[model samples]
Target: MNRNVILTCAVTGAGDTTGKNPNVPVTPRQIADSCIEAARAGASVAHIHVRDPETGGISHSTDHFREVMERVREADTDIVMNITAGGGGDWTPDSEDPTRGGPGTDIQTPAERHEPVGELLPELCTLDCGSLNFSDMVYINTAEWLREHARLVQQAGVKPELECFDLGHVWFARQLQQEGLIDGDPLYQLCLGIPWGAEADTETMLAMRNKLPDNADWAAFGIGRHQMPMVAQAMLLGGHARVGLEDNLMLKKGVMATNGQLVEKAGGIIENLGGRVMTPAETRERLKLRDPSTGKIVGGEA
Candidate 1:
């Protein structure tokens, strides 16, 4: 069991979850507030995504991103920001013309995905290693696209959190490491319980965990009901944990949960299992994230 665990709270996801869960932050102000609340409750990192304020739909607008970043920075909190570079990959085939994209399809080139990260220069950003079926829609991140995205992330001097939804994704992430695309010790987030991807179970998590690089700093999160259980499982297996409204919406079966409540609960679980949640500074040190102002990796064992 790992004594020190870094808990990242994914504040609001790029999902159609706001209507499902009233607490899912829609506007930039709400997202920034939720991020701060999670940080105060023991989250070491805040994984962020923006949405259209009027529609609450996922948006790739840099203006929205800037607003959230400004609010978070103005607050002067200790949370390490990790923005999503995983946007603009949704592709649903049009029934009328199968070759063309469908109504829900929103695909962007690799450079588009890297725009927010490159412009804002967050401490960390995600690099989705492969494409997979996201429910009925296909989230496309081909090898070529990934290579371009990885290179841009490396250029921006931001660490990429290799997000693996399945075993194949994990394999490709290792390949990226072999090719010397990622810098510093590799960081990963094993995304389980998403439909048509990896299942949320001990056997699955363990199998995927075994495939990661020896020096990787990895965390795992299960969507919906599997969220809290996977948190415990991840900690027991010597991996880190993630929580918040992005992966789950409730403290229990019928209860509506906020991001702060979820972080507090996850922290309680960590302490119960004889582990402690690492602070934001500690996680920054472990990931070797560049300081937001200095453009230099913070102090650590390295």
Candidate 2:
């Protein structure tokens, strides 16, 4: 089991979850407040995704990202910021014409998807290692696109949390490392329990964890009901943990959970498992992340 754990609270994801949970942060101010709340509640990092304030839809606006960053920075407590760079790959085929994109389609080039991370330069950003059958839609991230995206993230001096939704993604992430696209020891986020992706169970998590580079720092999370359980499972398997409304909505059956509540629960689980939750500073050193304030890598890993 891992003694020191890093807990990441993904404040709000790009999914259509705002309508389902009232506590899901939609506006920039609300998102920033959630991050601060998670930080105070013992989250080492806040994985952020900005939404359209007016419509409560996913947005790629740099202005919105900037606002969220500013508000979080103005808060008293500190937490490592991990912005999402895996947006705009949704491809729901049109019902009328199978060849055309449907209404839910949101596709962008590597540069467009990396715009926020490139501009804001957060301590960490996500890189979805491969595409998957994301619910009814196919989230498209080709190998070519991934290599280019990794290069851009490396150029910005930001650490890309390789988000592997399946075993093949783990393979491709290793390939990226071998090709010298990823700098330093790679950080990984094993995503489980999404529709048609890796299953949320001990066996699957272990299999993926076994494939990771020995020197890599990794965390794992399960969607919906598996969120809390995966926290314990990840720690037991010698990895870190992640929690937030982005992956799960309820703290318990029929109870909507805020980001702070999720972080608190995850922290409790980590402590109960005889593992200590790492602080933001310690997480930076552990993950070799760039300091958000100075933009220099910690431990001289640059």
* Highest TM-score model number: 2
What is the TM-score (0 to 1) of candidate 2?
Answer: 0.98
**Global lDDT of each candidate:** 0.92, 0.94
lDDT of 1 by residue, 1-302 (tens): 78799999999998889988899999999999999999899899999999999999989988888888888878867889999999999999999999999899999999999999999999989999999998999999999889989999998888999999999999999999898899878998999999999999999999999998999988999998999999999999989999999899999989999999999999999999999999988887887887776667897421
- Residue-wise C-alpha lDDT for candidate 2, range 68-100, written one tens digit per residue: 999998888999999999999999989999899
User: Could you tell me how far off, in angstroms, the CA of residue 20 lies in candidate 1 after the best superposition?
Assistant: 1.4
Q: For every candidate structure, what is the RMSD over all alpha carbons to the true structure, in angstroms?
A: 1.4, 0.9
| Candidate 1, lDDT over the whole model | 0.92
Q: What is the lDDT of residue 113 in candidate 2?
A: 95
Specify the poorest-scoring 10-residue window by lDDT in model 1. Answer: 293-302
| lDDT for 296 (candidate 2) | 78
Summed over model 2, clashes come to 0
The positional error of residue 246 in candidate 2, measured at the CA in angstroms, is 0.4
Error of 1 at 101 (Å): 0.8
